[model samples]
Target: MSIEPAGHGIEADNALDRRFSGRNEAVPDEAHHDGRGRFYWFLIGMRGIFSLPALILMTSYLGFAAFALDVGLTRSEAVFIWALPAQMILVGTMAGGAHLAASFAAVTFSSIRMMPMVASVVPDMRNDKTPTIVLLALSHFIAITSWVFATQRLRHVPRPYRTSYFAGFAITLTSINTAIVGIGYGVVSAFPPVVAGALFMLTPVYFISSIWASARQPVVKIAFLFGIVLGPLFAVIEPQFDILYAGIGGGTVAYAIDRVRRRRHAAGGV
Candidate 1:
């Protein structure tokens, strides 16, 4: 792929786009890409420092580090992984003497949630000139916060700049959180259960607000709300599969409702 030159004005950007626009076949990502583009997006991505999600994440992880201490983990072990769920599962398994196979399975299932998030944002972030490998590497950094930010904000960014923008943001966020975990490990270790629980709740509150803010379609909104409401009822009836049941059952019902609505709309329009 002929890498486009970024950090230039809009006219230069447009010129590069026109020059490369006709090369339709997929090319290796950024084989010829340069430092200027990377630097530009790095600056752009670092803006997350002041974002609400980033602040909330830093606070939540501060609380989570206390749990890591309880699990008998080193600061290095806790800082090694970025995803909270994966870190929790792997650390818990290690502490509980769970086998490698079981730990792997649990982590994979936790990662399954990332697939949809990656699918939604990555394509828009990539161009034909982008390397598939870059996309793959960037996918590793896409937790719920990054995914939500990218989906909601990246579309407004120039397409060619999207991947770099994401790389910068994700890298910065990861680095900051890792530092937070490492530095605050001892300080937060003695946090009481109530305070830790409250800090943990911050992440979910952000998730709920973000999902609501990002949902453009009524059907999508209904599915999210359905899952939220069904969760408690399902928990009472079948605790083990409450989340699974709430998710799949709610999604299936919402999908069916959407199809019927579409059909009715088609018929009524005709």
Candidate 2:
């Protein structure tokens, strides 16, 4: 096997990052043709916006909005937080009253999850000739919720329309959830403190449940288990850096385990 230089990997990641940083609304007219057309897939995507999991996702965001209000963020601020991709960081910063630099560091570390997620999903949605800007815009719509839906739904969607389909699903979900955040912030004051607290826990609980239900690979399952176990421990040890530590530690251990398992299987097969 041939090994690539470190610079090659850096250049590749830079290219991917650049694709997402730029903004473009138009998809190229000339791309792969899959007969069903982009609009048909887009309609299919719109149909998926109301899937049961999406309802659950809304509840989670509702809980988050209430939690943000409970922590003293104004209604507008709570809604503003929902607009950003760095949910965990924004929540942590607000709850812990951390400084901007610390919040930035935590958010950057946590966002490592998105890199692999985008890399995995984008190739399926776009061909080599798909405009980089269009690919970038679609990638921005990819958070944990939409990523799960996109990966599963794309199997049935024709290749050419996958991008448009994801666009429809993602945009619809984002728009609805953004509105729900505002609604939640407004209504939270009416509920009892205990109920409001429970609402605060809803999003994290839903996220864990989703991961448990969706994981098919052993390594991913292992990583998730490690994260679950290590999360509380690290939170106690270092509250602000808990997620950063758990993610890195859990993922590294899982990767090592997977590598060994693969090697053993290869040896046995040989």
Candidate 3:
């Protein structure tokens, strides 16, 4: 890599991006396109289980095990709903004697945040031979841990191996987490809510850190800022919808601000 004078903030970030984008010339592109290369990267991706985010996620699922037990759900049910927070709401609503339609509506609304996460990561990982079906299949594994893990690492990986790399990491992470829940399922009575709650708290703490590290785009930082400001405010106003409102409202505001900034910069007015 060429050495250059350092820049500040976003300028520094762009410099880093310029430094890494397609710069992995240690192996030729053809090598990565082959079965051997894909397998190698897949194994490399599996190493993500040792990462901090993966560890945090694994720890959090222990809490989820307790939650599942408390809710009278089977071990399999806990693993099923663990990925989608909205489904947890569905369980809670149905437990409260809510109608099926109402429970389904709540799950649908809570799931809206997943759309952007899937959209943002897929294009960057795609190549000429990558099929739409494969991408769609892989989308099921795209969650907070995998998204953050993959986004921060994908730029350095070869285009052809990106999907395999993601699959390795995501599948490994998911499998281990599932195992954690399964093993902890019948043992939740000994775990206690206080212990479980403390363990679950690691997720957001790592989430904020990981998001900040990978948020090179101005919109991402803007959204993070707005989320921080709006989350608690909305929590007090309406706890149930606080997450929905804060996420949508912050992202919308951030997107608008980023769009305006880009336009101004493009027009040479900044």
- TM of each candidate vs. truth: 0.78, 0.69, 0.82
Question: Looking at model 2, which ten-residue stretch has the lowest summed lDDT?
Answer: 1-10
Give the C-alpha miss distance for residue 70 in model 3, angstroms: 1.0
Clash count in backbone of candidate 3: 0
| Counted clashes in each candidate structure | 2, 0, 0
Q: Which pairs of residues collide in candidate 1?
A: 29-130, 29-131
Ordered from best to worst TM-score, the candidate numbers read 3, 1, 2
Candidate 3 per-residue lDDT, tens place, 1-270, comes to: 121122346645765675466565534676557789889999998987888878887877776787788888888877776574666788889888899999999888777778888898987788878999989989989887788876777765677888999999888888888888889897866866677667778788777766775676788889999998899999999987887789888889899999999999999964
List ranges where model 2 is wrong by over 4 Å: 1-36, 68-77, 83-112, 192-206
- Model 1 Cα lDDT, one tens digit per residue, 90-183: 8888889999999888888767656766886767688877889999999988987887677655654556667888888888988999999998
Q: Please give the lDDT score at residue 58 for candidate 1.
A: 87
- Tens digits of lDDT, candidate 2, 36-93: 5677777778777677556767776776776777787778877776534586566768
lDDT of model 3 at residue 154? 74
